[model samples]
Target chain A: MSSLIRVRPTKIELIRLKRRRELARKVYRILRERLTILVNEFMTRIRRAYHIRKEINRDILDVYNEAAYLLGLYGGSIYEYYDSTAVENSKVVIGFENIMGVKSYTAMMKKGKFINTYPELNEFRERSIMLISRIIELGRIEQSIKTLGVEINKTKRRVNALEYIFIPRLTSTIKYLQMKFEEREREEKARLKRVKSMLEKHRG
Target chain B: MGVRDAYFEDLVTRVLTRELRIVNRHLPYKRVSLCDLEKMDIPYIVLRDGTAHLIDPRELEYLTNLLGKDKCKLLLPIIIEARQSLGEGTYIVRDRVAKRVIAEILGVEYEEEKPLIIYRPHLYKIREVLPTTTTIIFSPT
Candidate 1:
């Protein structure tokens, strides 16, 4: 409960504390490295998501305009035609992607079978599928970023605790024990001197 | 020592041991080549932790194009060794083909048949392009 480790000022305790400190330092080094990698991974995903989102935003208007023009030309039947061309519905393969130890759900778009009848519809379908795949990728990156952020925070806390609180506490306790042993040695030397002087005075 | 100190020491040892054991657990049991991975319905490597670490087909294709005929020689899930003795923010890529591929991808030049030493920014760039196909191994020297 106290700031110092409650251990007797013995050589064995000192050895144990030293070993513990070494282990703590090793763990700290490793955790710090992990934190660095995780943060890097997080930043990478953030940048990727930003770029994908930007690309989608820039292209969405054009795609929408194309859709609107098609609607105006062919009316609502255009939607029916596009829908009817599908031999099967589009599929998304969803799975977990583990970046380091942080797991995030990733979805990859699987292109579906289509009749490939109308050129205009085909162009629109291609463009739409591209946009949709980008969106799915963006979603995956965003989720990964979120998960990485949480992991980074957790790792950072452990690193900080080890750096500031735990390692230092162990260090100070070790120092405290060392100093206590030295002081005891000094006191014993002084007492021996006094006792020898007294014995000499009696002999004199 | 008091029981509390003993308990704390035991706990610290346990935690550190666990971390050390699991640090590289995400690594693949056996790395598959790019050519082989491309042949699978779902390209993935079984991790030491018993989980399937998926490899993106896009990444595989990109590497294939980058390496050309040498794609078969290129291993899956490129291992980036982060050694503490290598100093901070520096990683080593020991695989000759992987080094060449990563160097090409990152637009960095490296001597032939030598280990590629990359900095933090380079690592970020590599991970960005090959998020699923690259894994980092932390080595506490």
Candidate 2:
């Protein structure tokens, strides 16, 4: 009775509470399922982001070494020279990618054309480009993980509320309504019986 | 109950209904073919929410190589239906080609006679390989 929601002790209210309880259960089940999937998605992205970060760390070191070596070999003007030889600047097409209702920015690189420079420099350029692509991928995953985390938290709250609060209250209220109706019926029967006895006594 | 309480009661169900309605808003209104997407400069599909969901060319190329001449049969943004009745952690992919593609990607065996049923781990693996190209829909049934 303490958990019962405040509602009129009528059949209509009982029916409504029952319906609400059913809806809450359905929603709870679905939301719980969704929360599981969202958590799984979060873990998957986290794993991927970790692996990508590892690869980027290793690749970045190698690229850095190459850059230092090239700098020593070709002097400071080498970067300027490389930029001047580029026929087309490197481009990345950034757009949104939605995954299971989670949206995040994704990027695709459009390789740039450049005049053939020193072979070593060309190798460095390719490595750097690959590194940039991996970084972009990392960014995309990181953003998605954040979004999924927020969604998971929100869903968990709703599921918890339905499970522990709303559904229980509705159930108790429904039970209260049923009990009230039964009590009224029993009282009515007893009163009718008392009146019948009184009429028999008067007639006698 | 007071009118205010009744209104509050409806509020709970209303919020749930709204959430369910928006769950699949990211899904495409009509899925496009992989070949058609390849022909476009910036490959993308229009979602039910009226936003463009971009597709990766690399994934398209990989699927193209896998399906070969049947690439056109493969649709953009593969749909994975998640049903509560299927029990927790299980999903179904109904399209024959999508089933084959997912099965091939996940290295799982499936029969053409039945829809492809995959578990959570399989889904994670598939999504890892084809993140942008795959979407999951929550089926109320």
Candidate 3:
């Protein structure tokens, strides 16, 4: 008679496989929730960035046009026509204390001196242009921040997908495989037990 | 293969075998060397020479088509030429049919190799090999 050969999976392995599946599912749920939040934050930031950029551009243009009109009164050569003597009278200003939200007064000071000396109606043109430049710089900073926010959100989403969707699916498949392995093992063990009993009976 | 490589391999197998149905719906697995193909569901094939790999199936088509019918007739020779130019280590073949077709036309030998892990940064690095001619298609899933 041919000897009976049996293959069986241990009980421990079956338990481990079940635990793995449960863990994978849990991870997937967590990632999905996190991803949704990140995506929402990203969209909100992008919208805010767009609105800020538009407002900055419009404000810069408005300031620039006003300066141009003022310069038009002084022969348009605001830089060349500046009053050199007024340098003594003009204070070296550091901040835009007078102008609300307009910073970088050093540039404004230079333009102010130039316009005062020129005696042209358009004398303030240079200062206006300088103010516009500052606004543009502020807009750039805002844009960079917005861009960074978008990138961070995208990265978060990617991580979430891997954690929730891809990893979970893989773990589930692995769990299935492990369970199948365990079932096969148990069947083999039963077969071996049956063969052993038969052999004992024969020997007795 | 490192974890990343294995992950990509598994991903490719799933894609090719239609296991990962949500991603890259157009890519399909064809009759190809199993070892070279690695994972069954993924949409890529492992290059014998290794080095860089292609992940975009559209890129493979664009490259093969650029080689023309005469060059594409057998497949292997073109793949060998591409591989020689590609240089070093295992690379995934994103477009199996195009790769095989090119290889067959070129009359080059093909062999199967075991799957291996691909690690991080390496996964991102492989993206460089994709053909610039084709638009990149990212699968969010």
lDDT of 1 at A143: 84
Better of 2 and 3 by DockQ: 2
Cα lDDT computed for each candidate against the true fold: 0.87, 0.87, 0.39
Collision pairs in model 2: none
Give the candidates in order of lDDT, highest first: 2, 1, 3
**Each candidate's iRMS in angstroms?**
1.3, 1.4, 22.1
Off by over 4 Å in 1: A87-89, A195-204
TM-score of 1: 0.92
Q: Model 1: which residue pairs collide? A: none
What are the per-model DockQ values?
0.68, 0.72, 0.01
Docking class of 1: medium
Which candidate gets the maximum DockQ versus the true structure? 2
DockQ of 3: 0.01
Residue B74, candidate 1: C-alpha displacement in angstroms: 1.1
Q: Please write out the lDDT profile of model 3 over residues A76-159, one tens digit for every residue.
A: 565354444344433222221100011111212222233234333333444454455555434443443454455446546655
